[model samples]
Target: MTDLTGTSFEFPGEYYEIMRKDFRNLDAETEFLASLLPDAGTVLDLGCGTGSNLRALRERGHRGTGVDQSAAFLEYARAAGDEGISYVEARAEEYRTDERYDLVYSLFMTLNYLDRGRLPAVLRSVRELLNPGGQVVLEFGHLLNFVDSFQPNSVGHHRRDGVLITRLARQFINAHAANWRNEETLLVRTADGTVAMYDNFFDQAVLTGPEVRELLAAAGLTITAEYGGFRKEPAPFHGRGPLVIVATATPADTASDTAQQEENQA
Candidate 1:
């Protein structure tokens, strides 16, 4: 039996029996982040699937490392043969690094994968690994994107990098319990006529806006700004699409501490 369960069609990898489509609009996505991080020197990407964002950053001369839990994704990232960049196969909640970065980001609601109980620890770890005056960007748009957007069962497909991908998605919402369960079946086909299929289950934490703010504050991080989309525009009261958040450590001595650490390392 073919082990298709390990493959994801949304972020395709080389190991999948059938070619899959990678994430969409990667160039635009990375460019939007670049505008926000004009002077960023070092970057750490948490939950970086398939290394697309890291690859985009490296192309523009930013030193970057990607961390994710998928071996298949990491293998695909390493296969890109980019020596200047690195990939770590580890869970975002459990991973640690000695190096601090000028920017630490988790995109596409990656934080939702971690239990709410673990979010504070993740933030603390992010705080400890940030350089002075650095920033952390988190996009929790999934929370909003999924609202009123799911139909009973829907199928869609697109072609990218020569791979064709078809996905069937369904949602079961429990409003009383604040539970949103999504199940997706991906059918991938290579240009060479090979085919593969896999099922993915995503059950995420549905948090209120105020609850998120309190959680960030409790974690010693402050929300600097929130955007409605990639444009960096102010989020509307009842707007749709993804919501992005920019944050930083709340301590006053973080800059000095970072300077001291850099000097000691030097």
Candidate 2:
């Protein structure tokens, strides 16, 4: 998430490989998003690890840029030399672009990597990077994802691309915001029977639906849709799965209205 600032942990060399191998939702995610894009639209994937989503978009006659903090992930993506997909290595919160995109998305709860203090910057950045009427699709784990959904401790196995991985995940919820932090240990067995392991750690803020909408409004963005899962259904009052938000840059009139309301409050 934040490059382990004020923290100590070794980043796994094969982190991206384990993620690509274990998490099996990239295709489904791209298909869900493809149905929502405008014709020939461009996308910018914040925290686009390994550029898998962008690859899927390219096959559908669309192109985009992928930005991430990991050089290894970006290099792996660039090796494809796919003209349709470009990448940059930068932290999501500090990165900016002069060119705007028709669709800007951060999937797999990448935004959660930014702690509460820095989320506003990302919201503003999304606002600036989006064209008028363009939408930003953000998916992130919610407090309920841990509180009501995932178990406190669990293990799973994945076998793909000639690698066998066993993941043991432990989650802890902070008392106040109910923010969820995860420490995952991966045991990877290579085809040659080499065994390696590493610990992956990250935390997500427990910002609720109201906080998200308010932050978007403050950033001159309007929420067009919010959901609990990938199926595009409305999120329950509290529930499992991520809180997926689809928002657009507010038009001039809506911006004016929001300013007026702020002034009135003052």
Per-prediction TM-score = 0.81, 0.88
- Candidate 1 lDDT trough over 10 residues, lowest sum: 1-10
lDDT of each residue in 215-250, candidate 2, tens digit only: 889888988888766677778776767789988889
Once model 1 is optimally superposed onto the true structure by TM-score, how far is the C-alpha of residue 178 displaced, in angstroms?
A: 2.8
Provide C-alpha RMSD values for all models, in order: 7.3, 3.1
lDDT tens readout by residue for model 1, 110-170: 7766666777888889888888877888877445556746577888886755767787888
Model 1 TM-score?
Answer: 0.81
lDDT of each: 0.72, 0.77
What residue runs in model 2 are displaced by over 4 Å at the alpha carbon?
A: 1-22, 176-178
The regions of model 1 sitting more than 4 angstroms off are 1-23, 36-40, 142-144, 174-177, 253-266
lDDT (Cα, 0-100) at 219 in candidate 1: 68
